[model samples]
Target: VIRGFSNSRNPEKTIRAYIQMLKTGFSPDHMTYPFLLKSLSRLLNRKLGGCLHSSVVKTGFVWDLFICNSLLHMYGTFRDRASARKLFDEMPFKNLVSWNSILDGYAKCGDVVSARQVFDDMNERDVVSWSSMVDGYVKSGEYNEALEIFDQMMSVSSSKANEVTMVSVLCACAHLGALNRGKKVHRYILDEHLPLTVILQTSLIDMYAKCGSIGDAWGVFCRASVKESDVLMWNAMIGGLASHGFIRESLQLFHKMQESEIDPDEITFLCLLAACSHGGLVKEAWHLFASLKESRAEPTSEHYACMVDVLSRAGLVKDAYDFISEMPIKPSGSMLGALLNGCINHGNLELAETVGKKLIELQPHNDGRYVGLANVYAINKRFGAARSMREAMEKKGVKKIAGHSIIELDGTPHRFIAHDKTHFDSEKIYALLHLLGTWMDLNVNNDDSDDYHCVCS
Candidate 1:
């Protein structure tokens, strides 16, 4: 009964059943604990999991490998790495499952650095360990590192990479625009003639789309062959098409998806809404945005922000204002900033000022909103307004947050800040930027696009 309940994806029911078991005096044993922990992990019930940990310790079975492994898994699910590491350190014996659980915890926590360190330390690694690390790197958005690991693992052991490894590698390659790497992986699958499961096929299509090779993406999609694919597969194709400026095709596919009886999820609408935004289809975007409820999807803060962005980009300043005013959920800082940015882009100082104030109310510590408002004033030649904003920030003890972008060279990431003098090549980079600025000033003057440089409006 505990196993049955734990296996259930409904977290509330799972937790309830476990509590019932405890009430009945069926002290959860080693076999019982993993399921309870798993359920707690699935529900992200950290408090309940901590209670369970105490129960295990009181039972004097904290050293049991299976229970410890389950505890590690629970910690991993919630990214409680400190607890997971302590548990790992105290394990009487470490097995493949044990190591994998800890590695999975680090990976899911977005600490790929720690996960890779664990992978390197493990004396005996099975396919699960390698696959977990690869998956972690992919989720961490380190596609190049994921690919490198895949290569190294293959060289060490000739075991064919599994669907999990392939998925991460494909996703990473697509994100990095490594068309050649994507093509090579696709061909490897073809040459080896690995069974094209639904999962693998979806990854293949997504890879092609992300790599900007729509032709290849379509070929994989056509080969899906099933009369009805999963909604996620449809979403991938739709999103991919929309990504490359094929907004009409994306909408057509959405229509076909409905006709084929594949029910859309919240993610589907999010993608569709984004496509509408990029293509300036304000009417269609509004229709689908309002239709989310009918599809049994609630509008998250992200969905609301996307709508604001879409309306703003299309220059529907009044409509965008109304949309925010009537938003079902409280406007988040990002959503308000999106509107403020759009106002800045369209030279609507009034709207920018209004939205900028709301944004400051929502996020007091954030310096970005203040900077954005100042930039809008600068664009409008309202230098006094801009100066007042700066003064207000100074009075409030708010400092402008330094901007930084990261670059990776030779497998090492380097961070650069505006006018930074910290990098090894700082002198050279600064000189180059200065030279470029001088060239731009010499050849181009007072371009309106400069106002729209990073402003969404």
Candidate 2:
């Protein structure tokens, strides 16, 4: 009965069964602990897991490899890496599962250095080991490192890359906008005849869309089997179209999605709101915002932020301000920043000052707020106040974050900062820029000829 309860999907029943077993004076055996540990992990009941650990030690099952591994996994799931590692070190004999569990614990805790150390120390590795390392790097925003590891896995590792590995690689490609590499992965998938699972197809669409290949994204969406396609696939395509400025197409897709039996989730509305903001559909945005409640989905900060952007961009700054004032949740920095930007654009200095003060209070350490406020003051010829804002930022020790841009070339991402000359081809790049500047000056001179003639006449 305890085994049945533990193996069942319901965690509450599992805990209740354990309680009943305890009341009946039935001490659980070694075989019983793994499934119970799994239930504790699923429930995220760390306190209960600790109690179970104590009981396991009392019963002399702590040395049991299966029980220890399960305990390690549970601690990892709880983000208690120290405890997991302690258990790992105490093990008399370690297997592949034991090593993988500890490595996963470190990875899940964002301890990439420790995970790498474990990976390097491992005598033998399976596909899971490689996938964990790659996925860890991907999660930690080390896309380049993740790709490099994947290359090593392909060239050196005997274990073949699986769907999990492909998913993480595709996610990295999407984030880096590495269309060249993403396309290569897609081609590899085709060459291998790997099943186009829902997740794989969704990631493919997202990768293409984010990489600015809307056409390829659409192709993948169209080719997906209807039976296999789900709401996430539809959301990805809609979001892709909207982000690429095909707002009308995105709206049409949203309507089609509504016609389907699948109900829209928060993400669907987020995409719809983004489409409305980009298309400047003020009326449509309001309607969609109202429809979110009808769908029984609460408005998240991102949803509100999008609405604020839509209103602000439409020159409805006052209305947006009122909306923020009446929001059930407190306004986030991005929402206020959007309104502040609109004020700067529309030359509404008064509202700009108001929003600027709120923004500073909310994000006192953010250098962008001070800079933006200074720009607003300068635009209004309030030179003293603008200088004061900068002085205040310096006093507060807030340094402006240097802006940078990324461009992918030949499947590698290159990052550049303003006035930076660190690239190997900096001299050649500067030469090309100088030539472009001369060409621009020549065009300006040509356009000024008519003005010169009028002055002479």
Best by TM-score: 2
Off by over 4 Å in 1: 1-40, 43-63, 345-347, 364-368, 387-457
Task: List TM-score per model, in order.
Answer: 0.79, 0.95
Tell me the alpha-carbon RMSD of every candidate. Answer: 6.5, 4.9
Give Cα-based local distance difference scores for all models: 0.84, 0.91
Per-residue alpha-carbon lDDT of candidate 1 for residues 229-285, written as tens digits (9 for 90 to 100):
798788889989998899999999999889888888888898899999999999899
Q: In candidate 1, how many Å is residue 64 off? A: 4.0
Pull out the clashing pairs in model 1.
342-457, 345-457
Cα lDDT tens digits for candidate 2, 1-457: 6567766778658778878888999988888889889889989998999999999999889899999999999999999988999999989989999999999888888888999999999999999999999999998999999999999999999998888889999999999999999999999888888888999999999999999999999999999887778989999999999999999999999888777666788999999899998899999999999999788678899999999999998889999999999989999999999999988888788999999999999999999999999998899899999999999999999999999999998899998999989998788888877876876787866664554221110
